[model samples]
Target: MTALDVPGIRQVGADAFTWLSAHRDAFALGEDALTEDGHVDATWKPLGELAQTCASVCAVTTPADPLHAPAAALLDFAWLQTGRGELFPRLQRLEPFATYPLEVYSVFASAGLRHPGYEAAAATTARTRGWRSVEQDPTRRLGVLKAERRSGIRRPERAAPLLRRTWLGGLPEPWTFERSSGYALTHVVFHLTDWGRAPAGLPAGLAAYLTHWLPSWLDTCLDAGLWDLGCELVVVAASLPEPPDPALLRDVWPRIARAQLPSGALEQQAPQDGADTEPDFLRCYHSTLMAAFAAARTVTRLPGADGPGRPPAHDGRHRHRGPGEHSEHRERRERSGPSGPRGEGVPG
Candidate 1:
């Protein structure tokens, strides 16, 4: 049986919290993505993503573990950093780079954690403004369409007519939505799930398209060593109203497990021959978290399946690998929401 690397999950989660905690300031409200200039204005969105991962790791991990409290604290710090939510004015100003409307804050809200400073007004305002921008000029609204769909505030009224039809139509392939970041196309599916809010936003056509194509998508991403994106898709697959193909889910595990490192960091991607970049913990963090989240939940409601806390059987994909085969040595690698009470389901 091959099951997920539970210890690896724990270590990666620990490493992420440690690395992120030490470098949390790097993801401060306004730090530049490429240059990472320090403490400027707090307008960026990486922190929101970071906080989401932290909350996610905490949610799956046993609460008795030592890292649980620290993970929860990370969310708290982020909430405080936003001045109880005032910094979003600055955060929204940056736009489309690392932040999204509903998706950003929803990460915390879904987990039922508290961020007293959460600004419903800011999220709503961003949603309202983005809809107007899409209406006035439809040419560059791909990003806007996605943000509004994910904003969770409401579908942008202006784009609503187009959204149900031509907006995101015809993406019948895996490579169709490659905008930016590691998980471009996968996130389209994610946003539809409202960050795992139950695929409330997934259009029937898109869902049908995914049902036909998702298994292969998982394979291609795995074969390509895009671990980060693959796991995101795993979560995407899990959120589908019907379960994903068991064969597809079974195939992804060993590839991910084999790539894991002793320290618990899963390499950000599969290694290529003579690849110069070394596997780094920071790079491995997101992928590792996703894997843990999948392992923690695959055994439950996600796709209405479960694969947690135990060993899973191996398969053909677990072929013998030579040294430096996949990432050549990189391997390895959540939460609550803000508000009323601890959430009861997947953290969207």
Candidate 2:
């Protein structure tokens, strides 16, 4: 496995997830943190999203991996405990519907973990409502649809228009690839295929867009050392209609690995004052979590026996990709009527 491995992509992924699992106190949302309305503090939102994505990515990977089951279970426990899944009573008023929770649910379904969140009527209702309300915003609506599909729910996708909206459709001329939008855009890509479960999830025009511009966007993020976003772009590349070249992530993986602290923490921002000023756990928990997940996902896609089941890599990197046949799936994605006529290429 080591011989076939690509340095930090695997090792750092394992270490970062380990740091998170061990240091649950610093990153996880507390039970009491929810407001009277059942809404968690905004502070935990990004961390929660990272946990959700990590749990999903961890779910399908090898069972023996240290981070796999534990991460998944922790997230499940947290979702149920937080009353986010309606496992318990909603102590406070409900937070207005956001598609973020659906992202977690979609990942959970893709990972095949059985949980009420996947089937809870409330959760489904929230997701369905979110999808309907976001008709004007295709990116968000597409994300919600992906969650529903990945959760094994059926969706008509578009209303009576007959031209169904793909995830990439309905964006402005200049791409919104900033941190928040980058995650949103990349996430939509992941959802397009449900994290590679359905390669056909990659629509024709979107695939064409990616084939032309992804390399530059990925390179820009890597050069900026935007480790978190870079990781997502890597996964986006991995989930392409065609098998991505092993060389795609070759340069950026090592740099992300290099950002890891001795404590297994992946720094979110530039180094702050000293250890004295900083707590044992720094503020970058979300980035670290996402970074690890990105690495694990990329490794599984990389060309090697270490992928998904040649042997128990046990590091989450050995997981296999879900089934995807480019030609057929792309056609289906095209037929769905998504990728709604964006002339400008990939966002800068």
Model 2 residue 267 lDDT score? 59
Q: What tens digits encode model 1's per-residue C-alpha lDDT throughout 206-325?
A: 777666655555555566676766677777776676655555555566566666654555665677773535365446656666665554434343332222211112231111111112
Find the 10 residues in a row with the least total lDDT in model 2: 309-318
**How many angstroms is residue 227 displaced in model 2 relative to the true structure, after the best TM-score fit?**
1.9
lDDT of each: 0.49, 0.54
* TM per candidate: 0.60, 0.69
Error in Å for residue 140 of model 2: 1.9
